[model samples]
Target: MTDMIDLSVATRRMDRVLDGIGDEHLLAATPCTEATVGMLVDHVLGLTLAFTAAASKDFEGLTDTPPTLPTGELPGGWNDVATARLSALADAWRDPDAWAGTTRAGGIDLPGEIAGLVALDELVVHGWDLAVATRQPYACEPDEIAACLAFAGTVSDEQRTEGALFGPAVSVPGDAPALHRLLGLTGRDPSWAPPG
Candidate 1:
């Protein structure tokens, strides 16, 4: 078995950001250039559900998740849906067995350990994306940041530079906060803000 990584803090951090989001900020820009706040939320929610299934090695009906959020008023019930799924994801992954053996996500096979890391990475990165886009407060503990940093190193430079999973990385000081380093490695500027 590999090292046991904890995701409780990352899930809590994302829950805080999701709860703070308002409808007005749904259209605001985020550090992820390809997606606005609403789209990113949808993506995170889809991923939460996807990885939850992955943790248990379940592959039924796993497929592409179009950037679809529930249709309704802006930001209508978004947080409730997202937080519940994220929490479920965290719970699903809590089984140590979930971190062993091969797992399926989106109909593709991946090591369960790798899939768990990806889940944590998604929460950390997109949680920050939502927080920044909405001007809400977010803080990640050192362990969460460290796991994401290690995940960043797993992505190919081409993918990151071509803006597939990430854009070209933004540089940050080594002495910066652990969360800032995690953001920078994921192609987000530590000091980025939406244009007023």
Candidate 2:
């Protein structure tokens, strides 16, 4: 069995990003050019819910269809909603049983342990997306970046070329820090910033 990973790397960073956002920034563009702050938060919420179900081995809402961009109202308040859901996500995966046997994330079926790591990768990468888009400082433990980078390396060139999982990995300087390197691997520029 793989050792339990500290999910705080993802959760703490995400919480910081959420806290840094203001209502006026909701429609502002993020690192994901096609997505704005609100759009990105919506996406995070959907994934949080999907992964929460995966941890429990529940598949009631799981589907072969790709996830539609979340368009739900953020009525409960963005910080309150995202914060609560993200916490639940961490708690769900904390259970050893959540890392045992097979589970489904969206439509894909994979091992529970693998799913948990994937969840972490999503949190880290998307958390960065939120932070950089909003011009906030993002700090994650080096071990967290290393873990995501290792998993990202497992994605084949073909999968990236086909855009099946990600865009082609962007190049980064050899001397880049782990987070910068990890961002580049996901086709994101680490120095990206919103227009003033």
lDDT of each: 0.78, 0.80
Ten-residue stretch with the least lDDT total in model 1: 63-72
Q: What is the lDDT of residue 25 in candidate 2?
A: 82
Off by over 4 Å in 2: 62-65, 161-165
Prediction 2 TM-score vs. true: 0.91
- The clash numbers for all candidates, in the given order, read 0, 0
lDDT string for model 2 (54-127, tens) is 98888787523456765635666768888888898888888898888988886988888888888898899888
The true-versus-predicted C-alpha distance at residue 77 of model 2, in Å, is 1.9
Candidate 1 deviant stretches above 4 angstroms:
63-76, 161-163
Error of 2 at 165 (Å): 4.3
lDDT of model number 2: 0.80
Instruction: Please state the error at residue 26 of candidate 2 in Å.
Output: 1.3
lDDT of 1 by residue, 14-122 (tens): 8888788777777778887767887787777778878888887776765334324432333457788877887898898899988999987755677888888878888
- Pick by TM-score: which candidate is best? 2
